[model samples]
Target: MKLTVVGGGSTYTPELVDGFARLRDTLPVEELVLMDPAQDRLDLVGGLARRILARQDHPGRITTTTDLDQAVDGADAVLLQLRVGGQAAREQDETWPLECGCVGQETTGAGGLAKALRTVPVVLDIADRVRRTNPHAWIIDFTNPVGIVTRALLRAGHKAVGLCNVAIGLQRKFAGLLGVEPPEVHLDHVGLNHLTWETGVRLGGPEGEDVLPGLLTRHGDRIAADLRLPRALLDRLGVVPSYYLRYYYAHDEVVRELGTKPSRAAEVAAMERELLTLYADPSLDGKPALLAERGGAYYSEAAVDLAAALLGGGGTPYQVVNTYNRGTLPFLPDDAVIEVQAAVGAKGASPLPVPSVDPLYAGLMANVTAYEDLALEAALHGGRTRVFRALLSHPLIGQYEYAEALTDRLIAHNREHLAWA
Candidate 1:
């Protein structure tokens, strides 16, 4: 099978390449294309990708290009990981929101709205190009604001699925704590992308015995520590919320913490520089250890599994993915995209039935879904009013004054990217 990576020049590409090399039997890629507009970075990342494949003695051929159509033409699948405005824009996304005394994050609050607006249009254009070239090809989006972007692709009638590393990362962590293989631990993961909870941890499969209570009884503190949440909160909620939830559960505290520390974008920019320098070394054949600190833990494994299943190859039958809800949760609209465990195959992902959600979580999910609706509107049809409404609707920035301020800041910082600005 042929695969294309649109943002193959990203520092994250090496981790993906490493997975493709190790999991060749699962995906069996015949050709792997890395497409990026940044020619210099693409060359560095592409060279490392080739070396990684060759070092593993994989039979797949790796190619690099700057042309989007050339990279995607006739591919079996296309993975979107592009950043519309790069790290500099991300720095602004992470910075300006805090000025409103709100959480500064890339996938939630005002910052996430900015990312959604900047990303959706670009992703839609790319999806349109892919459809024109290879109508049968599947689009796997790994980009930030995945829910919004995936919604855009699906709404535009593209064959697409969204992938995130959060579920896989948590699975690996839980497995280590339970002394079992990652595949042996099945999470009852539900909710929207980046805003999800592990309601249960089954031992063998989706129908296997739920061991969540036992896990909490034994490793609650450790898991809570990893999530940067209080152990008492986990015990009370009786579910493990994704780390991103910290922005909600402790909004003021998180904003204070964010104000004190350097933006994550700044740190990542520095790491990318070092990573690029390392990639230039001809002797470096494996993904550098520093890449792990760069984040997207276990991204490759998740991508491989999702791609394999979508292409009718060998992959885990049930995995966590973002797709149309289709009434998996009674509280959410059927068209709302949610992250949950599903039986994935060539047909697409179908979210498994989830137990009744506690109002606490369900209420938040509903609220965010509404905000996402407005966010997509602004993304599709840009205007200051749409932007302000999205910010006003977000639970994190519900106040009129804060929403107005954030809307202005978002537009000012992203005027170049927003055509209507």
Candidate 2:
């Protein structure tokens, strides 16, 4: 099988490629086509892939290219992990809104709309390329504005699935907090990207959601009693906690009441990094860090593992995927894409349907859902109206006049950055 990895410049490429390498025996990835706008970094990642393949005793083709058409041709799957602009662009997303009273944030609020505006065309262009070159290719999207892009792809009739590891990993954390084995826990979630809520948390099949709230109600205080919630936790968050639960705690009442955002998930990642540093040092007491993992391939390991599992017919693995709502999200717009649990298999991904979400959770999401809709419209129209509407309707950015003023400022400040006025 061949995999086309877009956005090879990601720091995570090391694990991503290594993940594929580990699955070599099962998938035997014959080709790895690494595409990136930055050719130098693409070359760097390609070199790492070569070293990984060399040591793995598996011979395969590794191609690095900036030519979009060449990179996507005939690939079984394409992993989309691109950014519209890097950290500088991200800083603008936060700081421009900070000029208003609106909280400076990423992935949600006016900043995310601005980002979606910039990124949608890029993602659409890539999707078009995949359509022309690899009609059968499955786009497993890791790009931000995931719901927007996924909807665009589906509306345009392309095969795509929006994926983030947060749900897979977040549910596991909740299970741990509830003092249950990880495998015993199951989650049902819906809503816009980085702005979702758990409608149901349970054990076993359809029966667990009923007991989850009560279990959490009784056990949650015990979990929170020892773990102090700090404000600076965003500094070290591992994978953005399913969606934007961090921001939810800060703004959304349902999330605050659920007591999840205060879980200090970032502290866990940060503390783990600290321990890793200690373990990796020569004078450290813990186990030695494996030298083979110093390369880039390890970064792609989970991605490749998941890919291989799907292709190899591993058990029905549930994934948090962004897909066309189609009925999975009962309250949200029908055409819009929402991220939720999906059962993945050889056939493909099926979005898991949960009983309707909570009124408070649904109410909180309605505002953000409008943000996603307006962002999509803005991307399509390239005008101020859609952006303004999205901004005016956001929950966190409730100050409409202030939001409008911020919009005008951002447009003026980012004239060079925006493709159009």
Candidate 3:
């Protein structure tokens, strides 16, 4: 099988390369293409990728290129992980939203909306090229604002599935807590991308008995601490919300904390510099340990599983992915893309039925669903009013004044990225 990574120069590529090397049997790639516009980073990352493969005795060939069409032509699958604007733009996304007293984040609130606007068009163009060059190829998106980007790809009628590390990260965490293998812990992870909750933790399979209550009883404080939430809230809610939800559950506090500390983008920029320096070393053949601090834990496993299943590579039948709701959640529109446990295969990913959602979570999901509708609208058709409306619709920035300020800030900071502006 052939695979193409569009943002092959990213610091995260080595983690993915390490996974591909270790899980070669699951997704036996014969040709792995690293396609990036940044040739310098691509050369460094590509060299490390080759060394990783050689170390593992994997025979797959590594190719690097800046030509999108050439890289994707006749490929079995294409993974989208590109940042439309680099970390410099991300720093703006992470800081400008703070001017409005909203949590500065890359994938939520005003910042996330900005990322969507900048990312969707570029991804759509690439998807168009992939479809033209290889219609049968599957598109696995690992980009931020995944819900919006995946929705754009699917709406455009591309063969696509969205991938996120959140579910896999949670599964690994839970398995460690429960003293089981990661695959043995099945999470009923549901909701839109980033905004999701682990409503159930089953063993063996999806139908296996739910052990969530027991988990909470024994490890509630630990889980709550890990999530940076209060144990009382976790106990009361009866579910574990993704860490991303901390922006919602504690909006003002998070905003205050963000204001005090440096932007996450700043920290990541420093991290990437160090990682790239490490990649430049000829002796460094394996993925650096510090890459763990860069996040996206278990990303390789998730990507390999999803890609193998999609391309008839024969892997796990059930995995967590972001796909159409298709009534998986009665509350969400069928077209709404949600992250949940799904039955994946050569046909595609189909979300599995979720247990009934509590009103507490349902209400928030519905609210965010509405905001996402507007966010997509703003992303597709750029305008100040559309931007303001999307910001106003967000639960975190519902007030008119905050929305107005955020909209202006978003347009001003993203003027170069926003064609309409």
Alpha carbon lDDT at 43, candidate 3? 94
| Model 1 stretches astray by more than 4 angstroms | none
Q: In model 2, how many backbone clashes occur?
A: 15
- lDDT on C-alpha atoms for all candidate structures: 0.95, 0.65, 0.92
**Per-residue accuracy of model 2 over 1-421 as CA lDDT, tens digit each:** 8888898655455456666666666567888888888875665556666666666666787789998888888888888888776656666776666556555554666677777777788888899889988888888777777777777778788877776655556566677777777667777666666766555676775455545456445654442332333323322221122336555555544233434332232333354344344333433321224423332222243365456655653533776667767777677777777777777766666777667666756777766777677777778777676677777777777677977897796677566656778
**Order of quality (TM-score):** 1, 3, 2
Per-candidate clashes come to 0, 15, 0
After superposition, which runs of candidate 3 have C-alpha atoms over 4 Å from their true positions? none
Model 2 misplacement above 4 A:
25-27, 55-61, 174-184, 203-243, 252-302, 305-315
- lDDT of candidate 2 at residue 81, scale 0 to 100: 85
Winner on lDDT (1 vs 3): 1
Candidate 3 vs. true structure, TM-score? 0.99
**Number of clashes found in candidate 3:** 0
**Global local distance difference test of model 1:** 0.95
- Residues 81-179, model 1: lDDT tens digits: 999899999999999998889988888899999999999999999999998888999999999899999999989999999999999999999899899
Weakest 10 consecutive residues of candidate 3 by summed lDDT? 351-360
